[model samples]
Target: MTRLTAALVILGLVILVTWALWQRSTAAEARADLAEQRLAESQQREAQHQMIIDSLWDNARRQANQRRALAKQQAALTRIASNRLATIEELQRENQALRAWAGTRLPDAVIRLRKRPAVTGAGAYHQSVRDPQPLQPARE
Candidate 1:
């Protein structure tokens, strides 16, 4: 081959190698950009998931606190009822008249009230207690 032909062939090979390297570099950059986008999306999804978990946890904590408060209230009510019953029994033991009253059966209206289903609120309880309807006979 002539010197000029050899030089031309060498130059063409150099250009081809440079073009291949540039294409590979561009492909690597594209892959890097895609990886970064995927990472950002994953982080956002994780943040949303964490938010849901935190909300659930807060709700659970609130329910537990309410349960504890209700339990304390129930204990206090039970103590008060027991004390009142004890006082009534002591007074009955000390007086003949009181013993006779304690021995008597509850009134029909009071018995019917005790047998009914529990009401929800204070207003509902008051309404139920004050209702003027006659009591229904108990089923056999």
Candidate 2:
């Protein structure tokens, strides 16, 4: 083949190879961009999941603290009640009049008060606590 013709063929082959390399570079860049986008999305999802987990942990911690506080309060109240009962029993033992009074039947009003269902909530407690008759008027 003529040198000029061989050179033209070589130049064409060079152009073809350069074009193919450019196409491959662009494709690689597109894949890299897509990978970066997917990575960003995954990181966002992970962050949201971590936030939810942290919130749940915080809530659990708060509830545990509340339960501990409630248990401590209950223990204190139980101790107070026991002490009061002991004092009353001691007094009852020491005094014949008090023992006789304790043995007497409770008043109907007192029995009704004791038998009433426990009230719940602020509104209900307020309503329940209001005395219908603060004091019995002196009989005419």
Candidate 3:
């Protein structure tokens, strides 16, 4: 009876030890899986943050380029306007000189033009000047 009781106790201890080892291995596996998951999640967040930073830089670069283009366009327009104004002033001066010459050359004609308000209606002067004799070139 004593030997049988000793054998039964040994068998029970063996079963208990096997069960504890199995439980320990399962817990360790669960901890390793949890750690790996956390690491994966951290790497993904880092990649996402990097992408966001890159996009911001790209946006800023594009805006700067657009601003530069706009500034260049504004400078070109300013130059063109200045040139046009200068040309218009030159033409006005030339027109004044021509008017003075005409007054000296044909005083009577100028007086007649001044007395008569110009025919402003469309085609009013189209057929008005009809001298039967064509003008001859002057002999100097």
lDDT of each: 0.92, 0.90, 0.81
Q: Is candidate 1 or candidate 2 better by TM-score?
A: 2
Instruction: For candidate 1, report its TM-score.
Output: 0.70
Model 3 vs. true fold: TM: 0.55
lDDT of 3 by residue, 1-140 (tens): 99999999999999999999999999999999999999999999999999999999999999999999999999999999999988877776789875566457555545555655466765655533442433345455
Worst 10 residues of 3 by lDDT: 127-136
Off by over 4 Å in 2: 1-4, 119-140
Report lDDT (Cα) of residue 44, candidate 1.
Answer: 100
For each candidate, C-alpha RMSD in Å? 6.2, 4.0, 15.3
TM-score of each candidate? 0.70, 0.73, 0.55
- lDDT per residue (tens digit) for residues 48-91 in model 2: 99999999999999999999999999999999999999999999
| Model 3 residue 33 CA deviation in Å | 1.1
Q: Can you tell me which runs of candidate 1 are displaced by over 4 Å?
A: 112-140
Residue 40, model 3, lDDT: 100
